[model samples]
Target chain A: METLSSLAVPTVLILAGLVMARGKNAFDAFLRGGAEGMRTTFSLIPSLTALICALSMLRASGAAELLTELTSPVLSVLGIPPEVIPLAITRPVSGSASTAAFSALLEETGPDSLAALCAAILMGSSDTLIYVMGMYFSRTHVKKARRAVVIGAVGAVMCLFLSAALARIFFRDAA
Target chain B: MIGKCFFWICSVSMVCSVITGNTSKLASAVFDGCADSIELSLSLLGMMCLWCGVIEVFRDAGFVGALARRLSFILKRLFPDCADDSDIMGDIASSVAANMLGVSSAATPFALSAMEKLDKRNGCGDTASDDMVTLSLLGCSSVSLFPTTVVTLRYAAGSESPYAVLVPVLICSVICTSFAMLLSRLTAKNKPLGKEKRKSLGKRKERL
Candidate 1:
């Protein structure tokens, strides 16, 4: 209820702007971007949608819960709180879903919680490399990206690791 | 297409839950979760439109061209295969600018346009040169300094301190971005620069 209203505010504001700009070539730009977006969505969404469904089943079946339990102690050495495992798992897979997961953590456990902070930090800093990158580059003819791919994946993980480490440093008291 | 996929995923997940006799629980959970998601997406859409309009205004005011001029050096280093006058700079700048606003959707076309501009400039119709790949990859991993969409989601979800992630987000983005740039330079170095332009890419100190 509160969430939907807050969300509606921005959409309405943009709608107003769109109305104002409607006569100023906004409609054409919107349609063009929409069409292009639709095409690109087709290329990637099939596989991604399937994965999300599978993941949802996993989440429902408590696989994520089990995995979180399994990795919690090991990740404790890494300084990431147990609650952040979902973010570390999902952010690399789906940014939006991770955002939801992280926000739910905030709502359930309170926002200032170090785990929520780490999850938020990780989400903001890292890219959904597997999904977004794979989707985008599949459109172009890019074959020789071995080094780029390596650097990208490694850098994403490094950022994830750095987020956990720095979160512990910043929120040592909170933790 | 995505809509169909979503419909399918929902159906499949519902079937799975029913088989496990937890359909009601998961469905209710999904319903609540989706309400939040739709809202967040709306907020993101608005913020993205505002930023897009702002970027358009900046472009109208010659800021876009100025940015291209300012990025000539780093752009030169990152994309030595491209000429100074190429449209790749605009694409990169626009894409980066869009990402800065947390509008990944808005950034996509600009990124594609940028890559296309690079390919055309290098006269590589089929095989993308290494520089293009690095730039595209770097763009994909934009490592945003601020994540407005995520924060908005948090705030809407009743986060007590939505801004707490800001500092860590900036730090991690800076590290990842620097790491990406350094790695890109090392990988793409001296390969396309041949023998002449390689020297120019070295520790260039200049003001545009």
Candidate 2:
């Protein structure tokens, strides 16, 4: 119930500084955590960079746009609007990519669009299975990447359902 | 170092993204998108750094290890292949902690680490371990308390109905988690975690 998350890092730092004055162990703990935090974050660079780069290229080359154009008709049937298609397509590929798409959607269409809802559902419910599997599992020495796909597919379908159901019930902008 | 490398990579990629545009208008759209993207990256950087700090405090307090032990029960059910205590469990705790805050991107490495631990024990056997399957199936979904990306997207889009999504998302997360758990329970058994590991984990707990 009590999460340090509620406390800003500065406040936490001040508190920890008090705790530190009380005992060196607390300071040690904070330093250790910061070090580990930095290291773990650094490790993500490989996957994070690749994902951004790929998505960037996709966007730059109009691959995302073309893909959107192709999927637009199908997405239309799902009640997802045109502006939101990029987020939908990108969501499963990379969270950052989908986020970039969401930004564009928000910039172009406004956030209340039905498409934004769909994109959000996609992000909330889904995983970037391919990137995850490739990076995490590959290092873990897992040979097969197929299972991640299955799980990803399941997540995607569930997201699709949730989006549609919510759109039907809450999204009044059928126009 | 990695952060700097990736930051530049992202910047270049975004610029490349602009130039590669066959049409001119989309270049602006892509640039506009990057503004928010950069902000999100900063927030994630700040938030995740803070969590990492909290985790260190938890480590010093010995709370994370204890929490890991408690979670090991459920984890045991999911990853019979892994040791009782491990860095992976610690990672899972951090991952879950991050997930609670709507930092799924931050959680991926931990989830992968946890899965790797489970898979290590998966043993090149005929059937995949039940725990491995459950971990895969249960996975991570956005829970109720904090749904940052959802809120952000809505906010960015200028949603009059931004908060309107809270209930539906909360309910959907619960239902989907339950559904995945149920299905994992029914199917994973035939694959592995049958009568044996269940009894084994129970005995282990009794001893603990």
Candidate 3:
């Protein structure tokens, strides 16, 4: 995993070398790109602010816990570990909250425990679906997301179930 | 759609907080959330700029175009409606590549650029086009080869074999992404295209 991450930089360096070899001024192009990136970030702020605030409100009001309690029984019946239910629920909503839930689970269950492994797999396999949708759609004039939400929800639910099932299959003996 | 969801989320949180006598915490969360969003975006700025810069260089070097060509078969299948638009295809290619690398800061700019182009192609309509929905779905359920953040968190949490979950994550993500693609394609077919576009396509088919 570490080696994979280390490769990301070198890949960029090789790309830059190619750019220079092609006789383009790489540094000048980079500055132009940087400016464009700045504009993108600024445009995204309002949407990000709205989403983060709502998510945090959901987290703080104890609604998240209530929702988890309501869903726990069905989730358990589907073979999801009870301890990682919070992680599953938050995983698609917000990235930071899910990370916090993940670490909290690790601390509670111990890093080597079945629940921790399951949570790890769950967190690793999925992106923050709702957050990504919000950011991606914010720029568009599109009001109705149509079936996008349903599609994302389907994918996210599949990841959650697969994470639990795969963790058990791969790590049951180790646990 | 998103506005309604966001409105309800905030309102429900407020109502739940009041009923549970936790308004103070809720109030604090409101401020914290705003502050956190800014902080997060600012922190991401440097990386976003760096990667976008690299991507700009890639565009100039014609590498992004080459990538679009290389991935044409699958991308064409995924984006049937707008597959002929090389600009859209190029942005999608770069974004997907960044996503696979787990470099989201880089991915967002590229994906957003693609979204803008798709929006224009859709005539700046309020309703999302089929290709737009597919792009967002693909972005949401991207098949990331490296679950870098999760591995680091596990390692910090004292897991003996932090990378042990790599294969499982890979399997799960690949399956989920495939499912997402299939669902989007199926839904796109069922939704029915706009009248003019459909007729045009039919006419083109007849001509062919």
For DockQ, the strongest prediction is 3
Per-residue lDDT of B1-208 in model 2, one digit per residue for the tens? 3344345534655565566644554455445444544554554555455555655564565543465456556654544445466676667665655554443555567777777676666664434455555555545443434455556456545666555665556666666666655556565544335677678879989999
Query: Per-residue lDDT for B53-84 in model 3, tens only?
Result: 76677666666446546766788778878877
Instruction: Give one digit per residue, the lDDT tens place, for model 1 in B150-188.
Output: 676567667766656676677788788878877777776
The candidate, 2 or 3, that scores higher on DockQ is 3
The superposed Cα distance between candidate 2 and the true structure at residue A144, in angstroms, equals 2.5
DockQ for each numbered candidate: 0.23, 0.27, 0.46
At residue B8, candidate 1 shows an lDDT of 50
Please provide TM-scores computed only on chain A for all of the candidate models, following their numbering.
0.60, 0.56, 0.61
User: Which parts of model 1 are misplaced by more than 4 Å?
Assistant: A1-60, A135-139, B1-24, B35-68, B83-85, B101-106, B120-128, B143-145, B189-208
Instruction: For candidate 3, give the docking quality class from DockQ.
Output: acceptable
Interface RMSD of each candidate, angstroms, one decimal:
7.2, 7.2, 6.5
**Candidate 2 per-residue lDDT over residues A6-73, each given as its tens digit:** 33334645754665676657767766666766665556544544444444444655655665688779
lDDT of each: 0.62, 0.56, 0.78
What DockQ would candidate 1 receive versus the native complex?
0.23
**Residue by residue across A1-175, what tens digits does model 1's lDDT show?**
2354346446644654555464566555445444544454344433443444444554574545565788888888877678777667666666545555565566656766777777777778877766655664555666555666677777877887888787777667665
Name the lDDT of candidate 2.
0.56
